[model samples]
Target: MDFSSKLYSIESELTQEDLDSLKFLCLDLLPNKKLLSIKSNLDLFKELEKHSLLEEDKYDLLAELLYIIGQHSLLRILGTNKWAMQETLKKNRTVSLYRQMLFQLYEDLTSEDLKSILFLLNIPKKYEENKKFLDILYYLEKNEQLSEDKLDVLEKAVSMVSQELLRKINDYKKTRVKENTSTQSLYDDKMKLSIEVVEQVSSQDRGMKSTVELVQHVSEAANGKDLMDKNTESCMSDLSLNEQSETEVYAMNRKHRGYCLIINNSEFMKSDPRLGTEKDADFLTNVFTWLGLDVQIRNELSTQQICDCLIDFKQRDQTERDCFVCCILTHGKSQAVYGTDNAFVHINKITSYFSTKNCPTLAGKPKLFFIQACQGKTHQGAHAIESDAVSSVEERKTKITIPDDADILVGMSTVDGYYSFRDIRKGSWYIQALCENLTKMVPKGEDILSILTKVNKDVSEMEYSKDRKTSMKQMPQPAYTLRLKLVFPIPLAPFKPLFQETN
Candidate 1:
């Protein structure tokens, strides 16, 4: 079969991820502009064919690239196996030292390291948007900002991120110098052969053969460098998350932290208006916005609207987000919170919208729901200690049901069969305390559970007074199926500037 037909057969077997790897490997072989347009393996093979590196008779470069990328199984299409290629590479491998070094650096640098490196780089905002290391390197090459010989900017950037990475750069530099020396020696040997060919006039055929061998050697060396570049690019693309450090902390590195959807049902059609729900919504928006979330408040949603809003949020492409937050401020009953239309939306139904089967994007990420409503009509009375703190408490109580899934946290205004307090002027006792603790404790590097514990403590101490005596008390509750600790560290830049909303 012809080379193009063979490539077509190979392409059919490879996934999009495999194609991406193949394209990455070609970074050194082709220009950035060309690569950006070459979407498929056919397009890539055409470019290689034009360069005469992937013809039917000459495909060792392709074989070597496949071997480097651990796709030696694919080498069967090129009529080669890993064993034969391994033996060939042992004597003379073509992939370059510089390319291999960069691949190692790309593999070694953690996601945090990539961010740090990107911060240190002086590239344009457009290029910096792509977090992929290969793309960044391509941008550097395209802009003529970095190259094999130009190691200053890269070394400086690596030094700031990691000493080990910097060491790799230095090692590459040392090895590069040695390669230069060896190339100069090869040049000297070629010159010596030229003189020998000149002196051997009687043996014209032998002199011609010697010159041909020298030319072939030079061509092979060039091909070797090209192949190495491709191999390095492709290998870098294959980096997996499993290679990263095994940590208990969930990854929270994203452009936007996640969405904070607040359903603030203040005015109800059938029931009494939630007096201080506006304050709760405002506080939640500010707190979540300060924590780097995109806060959106939906006022007075009905049962259907609430369900649709949650469904919309769950169906959204949350690939770039690290967490999902939904805050509900309304009236409540036994096992559910009441919509503005006095319809009961069960807490389980609300949480089910973001379950793994429903919302795969948020499968392993933290999903936090904070409810500010009463669970029952039963008021939590203070038995041992009572203090004078008069706040109008909500008579409607709501039960919080946690879904049987991992990485979910439900913060209830009060425990089952109990009334939760809400001041006419301020907000719900649970929400105000929750927001206060989030603002105070998040900056102190406290986890969400720890902050919630503090909220419980703060709310449990307060008492509402009817006439002169303290009459009502409330205790906030937290139900969690979290696998990892969720901590929102205040950004280095001040929190005040991160969020600006009118209360």
Candidate 2:
């Protein structure tokens, strides 16, 4: 044989080590055939058939491997053989059925939800079949014909898909967890602690074990189990002097720390009209609250109102709190966000309030700022590191001096000068991605910087644009000055007693 033919022959041979490893794919799932007969990748499928007796994990592993292998082979054989082309055409129909099934399961999904879900599942949007899935979803939602039952099914499917993608992303994340592996703990790594309580309570109780079911249960319950305004008040009410109890110190202690301040500016002066910010505020409030922070949400604040709020938060006594987070959802050009009354508040002005010299209570704490407004009024021609609503393009680096002991992290939705995209119904892309990843990563013990890095990846990969002919892309930017790692601890249980008598 010539050199090329020899190379092919060598590639087709199964080495001893490979044979040893292949056994883990399961002998039962392997077809009854000679291993040497497979001269090309296309023919490998004939040896990868599964038997009914095989365990589920082995079967799944074999299936995933075979699917990948077959995909490669099919691309190599594209249009070469008449029979092969015909078979591939038939398989395309199967993929169509699967896509249709996904839509049927989540009928009420908005266009934005469909896009976010696909990205969350690591599904590729390049394929025509996937594009059709989105096209149909957009149409149905526009017509307001999607069903609630289907929406429920879609959420479950999205959760399953995320878990599957995460596993596939890590080679060591096998289908079966080893008995001695520490990963086999009683928790799903993706769950936030508050959501975990809701889930486990429902499961051990045998009534429900999911976010949706538990929320519905609370709403249906007779007592004041309502989680929104009422529970949030209970969380904040501890700060009041009149409501102070002797046992309060055990729960929250004397320090007014661990609060998430969300400033949502949806309405704007007639000069700069925008939509969909309110959606972001609502979702973020729910998420941070579920993450165990006492949330303070305000909407439609003007420039002065914005300043006052941050100053108040900065002045709070945070001795016992571990960290502080502030989120802003609004519109603006470079270097500032617009208050509801159309006034500009420089981003630094809001953040500077937390400096060690200014807010001594938060001197060493991690003060995080999440801004979801367009920084400038320019686009990088489909390739911009940008933020929410709309912004221009410009690269800026400014250093302001502060006291020696200060810790801060500022997360901008985009780079200095580009438009930040948001769906009229779904909210800004950055905030949604941020909330989901925080929920997914925090329970698994990921640090703040690592979690923000994932948020950057998640937002950057998603394709967003005002029009399809010229699609847009976004890349988030994080700037921080810290003396130590900022890892928000998981609150395993409720702080019921609130406080205790000092020593």
- lDDT top scorer: 1
Question: Model 2, 35: alpha-carbon shift in Å?
Answer: 21
**Model 1: runs farther than 4 Å from truth?**
1-247, 378-401, 495-503
lDDT of 2: 0.55
Q: Candidate 2 regions off by >4 Å?
A: 1-257, 378-405, 491-503
Each prediction's RMSD to truth = 18.2, 26.3
Please report the TM-score between candidate 1 and the true structure. 0.47
lDDT of 2 by residue, 85-203 (tens): 33333213112222333323343344555566666544434542445444444433345543322343334445554553322222121211221232323123223445655555656
TM-score of 2: 0.47
CA lDDT, every prediction? 0.72, 0.55
Tell me the lDDT of candidate 1. Answer: 0.72
